[model samples]
Target: MASELPMEEIVRRGARTNFEGLRESSFVPLFLTLWGRQASDDHVRQQLKRHYESVTDHLVGVYADFFESQGWDPRPPFTIRDFAVTLTALVEGLTVRWAVDPDAVPLEMRSVQSSMRVERQDDLDAGPWDLFGIVVLALIPSMTVPRIKRDSELWADHEDVRGLVRRLRETWESMVGLSPPAEAPDHTAPESADHCGAEPRRT
Candidate 1:
């Protein structure tokens, strides 16, 4: 994130920088003000509501495909945290690929809304499939998974992105000995049946 400058052009690269430095940047205030207003506005609130509902529906469809592929029944929808994490992972993955392949749509998308002109975002907003925004905004949800995973030690469970498959597999094998409650033997079931018929004659 740091850029080099010749000795003559001294930029203050330090711990406590000046407030004035941010003002020099073109899009900072523009994007913040715009996003601040839009995010809090009633219109934006309605839009966000609709978006969450639609994405929840989308989660259902995605899980349907998932279960179908595995020959398992579709379970209930994800918890909010799970849904958000899954969405972030998908989006961040898109951003990673977008960074490599600079297709016009992807290239125009910036990390923050203020990085570009509002008109530009609006223009790209309606463009074919919103390919840029779809992948760009999609990133918000997909990004935080690995961080939380690392903190919680759940990183070892995933093999797809981090390439920790071998480690994860070893850990899984190590922990696979215990049967779950549902699969564990229920001693009372058969014992109850045996005692039931015999004791019922006395009743």
Candidate 2:
């Protein structure tokens, strides 16, 4: 379900859905305890361990594809697999917390706001942001860079305009996981007879 959705929706719905499922499932605690016990149930423990590792590996692949599709490169000291592992851990921890105290990790918590600049009116109109979504949003900046191509217009603009445009586009990418549609035009392709921005040669 998460893989089919856009990044923004994944951040919102993905985390919430996982938390809700884990918190409500009676099998989660049962499995955890069963895996931890040192009784003679070694076979059961090995099966559970393999299952957990398999799930983690699947998540790693999904996340790697998602990040690559969005043209985001990981920052130094972190890899795509690392982000996947972190996300898995985050959901697991949140589930435990929610199981302990539902009120503390409610589906709609107002106190926690992501540091990312909230998208304009669209996000506001979507209704209240949840704690899970906010945490996912906050994690984006530190882990990825907007390595996508810039718009051609950015190259033609003044320095300040270029900077502002770049920053805005980066924020946009972080929020929606989209990149500029086209790359900046090549300026060195043997200047045209009627240079771009130059007076029209009165032919």
Candidate 3:
């Protein structure tokens, strides 16, 4: 059912789901701490590795579908698999920070006006959600623009690329002016099962 949604919708839903789970459980943090200290333990390391691999594989498939639906080719130099791995790494790094200090890390989804508070680096009270927005904005253009340019079908002329760049710039500017939201959006809403193609079964 989830596989039928647009890429943006899927990502939003997944993030909401993850935030809810993390809020309800301390297990993820405890496991990460233990894994960091017990890196030499083959059994524990293998379990963690397997989990990451599974997530990466799932993301790759999702991204491949997304790119295809956008009229973009999922080929080398900017492959869906590589993008998934990078995205997974980004999320894991953010999770580590959240685990260390949940309050300081903003993972919710409310109006930016409610949570734009900032503090010094030493104070460690910076708005992480704002940081996330900046990082994502920077990453999307750097990653996708080149790929879109490489494919003639995706980019008909200079105007097309320029239009994308202009939109990106506008979004970045707007994001810079806002802060992270305080509450997460509802993730319990039902999604359609209208698969664009054969949906892969998740493990």
Candidate 3 residue lDDT tens string, 97-190: 8767877667643455244433233533333333344344345543553335655433333344456555556667677985435688666765
User: Which 10-residue span in candidate 2 carries the lowest summed lDDT?
Assistant: 153-162
Off by over 4 Å in 1: 1-36, 72-85, 92-203
| Number of clashes found in candidate 2 | 0
Model 1 Cα lDDT, one tens digit per residue, 53-119: 6756765565344333433331123233454445434443444454456473342224443432224
Name the candidate, 1 or 3, with the larger lDDT value. 3
Give lDDT per model, in order: 0.39, 0.67, 0.56
Tell me each candidate's TM-score.
0.27, 0.57, 0.48
Better of 2 and 3 by lDDT: 2
**TM-score of predicted model 1?**
0.27
- lDDT top scorer: 2
lDDT, model 3, position 67: 60
lDDT of 1: 0.39
Clashing pairs in 2: none
